[model samples]
Target: MRRVIVIPARLSSTRLKEKPLTIIVDKPLIRWVVEGCLKTGEEVILATDSERIADTVKDLNVKVVYTPSELPSGSDRVAYALRDERVDHVINYQGDEPFVYTEDIKRLFKALEDFPVATLACRDTEFYKDPASVKVVIAEDGTALYFSRSSIPFMKLHSDLYPLKHVGIYAFRKEVLLEFTSWGQGHLERLESLEQLRLLEKGLKIKVLLTDNYYHGVDTEDDVKVVSERLLKKLSNPTTNW
Candidate 1:
């Protein structure tokens, strides 16, 4: 299938201001993400509403599509940017995940061959109890049963078993992505603020691809520093795993 990756960037990020332009080591965070995506050699497009963000991507000789600022979420922006394309599949990769491994991207794409939508998940930790760490429950067949910001499964007998943390990466068939944008916000989606639930509510199938590799995504100033330090460590020790 013809595949493309779209990074939904915006000028106003509530957590870190103008996050896409934030410098990580010697390059903007988005540039690192773009480079990682480049490793896959799939066509990539930056979907944004700001000229600053657009120009930044252009400076790197990367393709970008400017969408409206009124869009409710990144998923909507992705749908708008991809509306006219004849591509068979699209990957919604968050701009903040600078360390997104090429292997994870390829894994998600491979999972989508039979799944309507595919995403990454890893064993969770106590830190994931925070509502900000989105969690998911996967069925034995590798399908997602539910996605939530809160802890799922409500372990009646708590033990060392870890939950799954929903990594922000997602892959979908072109038609499924367009259909997702058309779906009205469902109750679970509205309450949880998770657009993926809207797809599940509409009876769409989502497959979960399990991975153990962890990448820090920039959500706050601290996250930026943390990821930068991690990158620097990797740079100094080329053999160090990220």
Candidate 2:
């Protein structure tokens, strides 16, 4: 049961230019993600298209695989990178996401024991109205009902769980990934421009694990400032767990 964390980083980003190379605090954003994933003691593979992106983490103890820059999604980049690897499970850790928790990672992989696809979410009202932050609505059994860029489950009554901030990190069984990447883009996926929607449209159940841990993916200029302060604070306060 081998599990590997594959991080896909691209040089270009529509929201934030050179997102992977953007420096969060004292290090590059990609480096922060790489270092955190390394702490988990799992085989970490960095799937990137830029030499500049790969060079940032050149010193790290991680396998760097270069994929085509034209790959449509992060999931595709990882799948391309891992084409020759002998592994049972793969975690598509978004490069823009700087926050990485070991326990949360373990839980994601553990879910694949029963679920074909699994992801993370937390109760963050901060992302409720923010379109950049995709929101998710889950069923009673914890499987996702839908994910949308627009605010979902319109809270006329207001429940704490009504709005769950979808964490982009996804854990996929190797076979499931093969199936996902092979499918054509779905209607909802094309409209919303979210790759995960393609899975739900195809009747693939997505198990979303709720976590209290902090996760902030750098998307816009504002996120950089927020994450920089948070990273600096974490570095200063050795005991502070983010």
Candidate 3:
């Protein structure tokens, strides 16, 4: 299937302003995300509403699609950007995930052959209590049952349960993406403030793939420092498996 990666970047951020242009280890945060996607050698496009963000990546050898500023979410911006494209699949690689692994991206692509939508998740227990860390519960067949900002499957009595941290990376069939954008906000989605729930509410299946690779997404100033240090280490050790 023909596939392409689309990154949604916006200048306005509630926690960190001008997030895409924020400097992380001498390079813009968006630049690092774009570069990581580039390692896959797939066509990459940046979807944004700001001309300033467009100019920042002008020399990156990637296409920049200008979207409207009123788009509600990054997923909406991505759908608008690929409206006229002929791609069969679109990977919504969030601009904030600078530490996204190319291998995990490829795995997500492969997963789309069997499922219409797929995402990456890694095992983690430390961040389960943190609402910012989304959690996913999967069925026996590897299909996601639910995605929540709150800690799921309350370990009220069990100590062996560990939560899966949902990675922001997603691969969507072109038609599915369009259909998702057309549907109104779901009750669960609106309440949880998690967009993926809208799909589940619509009876669409989302496959979850467990990955060993760890991804760091920058949402606050403290995240910036953490990502910067990890980025420096990755650059220094090119052979390091993520």
Candidate 4:
């Protein structure tokens, strides 16, 4: 199936203003995200509402699609940007995910063949208590049951369950994406402040691909520092294993 990756970038971030343009380790945060997506060898596009962000990646060898600044969510921006495209699948990759793994993206793409939508998750105990890290619970067949900013499947006693941190990246079939955008905001989605919950509330099945790779998204000034240190470490040691 024909597939393309779209990174939605907005300038007026509530947490950190101009987050996409924020410099991290000598490179713009959006550039790092775009470069990471490009590593998957898929056609990657940047969908943005800001001219500054669009111009930032002008020479990055990737196409930039402009959408209205009033779009409610990243998914809406992506749908609007690719409204006329004939592509079979669209990957709504968040512009702040600088550490997104190419292999994890590939896995999500493959999973899309069996399900209309697919996303990535990683098992990490440290993030269980951290509400900033979204968690997901999956069914036996790998279909996601729920996504929440709080820890799920609360272990009252000793158990083998580990919190699966939901990665922000998403892959959607073109038709499903269009349908999703058409649906109005869901109650659960608004309550949790999580867009993916809208899909679940609508009874749409989303396949969750378990991966080992963790992503560090740039949300605030502190996040920039954390990502910068990670990038610097990688650059300093080329052979350093992840």
Model 2, 122-201: lDDT tens digits are: 99887789887899999998999999999988988879676899999999999899889989999999999999999999
What lDDT tens digits, residue by residue, belong to model 4 across residues 1-242? 67999999988899998899899988888988888888889998899988899887787778888899899999999999889988998899999988867787788788888899998888888778888889999999989999998878696775565678888889999999999999988999999899998899999999988887657788879888888888898889977745
**Model 3 TM-score, all chains together:** 0.95
lDDT per residue (tens digit) for residues 43-135 in model 1: 898999988877766755467889998898988998999988889988999988987677878888887789889988888675467898899
What order do you get sorting by lDDT, best first?
2, 3, 4, 1
Q: How many backbone clashes does candidate 1 have?
A: 0
lDDT: which candidate is best?
2
| Candidate 4 vs. true structure, TM-score | 0.96
Count of backbone clashes, every candidate in sequence: 0, 0, 0, 0
List TM-scores for all candidates, in order: 0.94, 0.97, 0.95, 0.96
Q: Which candidate number would show the highest TM-score if scored against the true structure?
A: 2
Q: Model 3, stretches more than 4 Å misplaced? A: 156-161
Candidate 4: the clashing residue pairs are none
Determine the C-alpha RMSD for candidate 3 after optimal superposition of all C-alphas: 1.5
Ordered list by TM-score, greatest first: 2, 4, 3, 1
lDDT of 4: 0.87
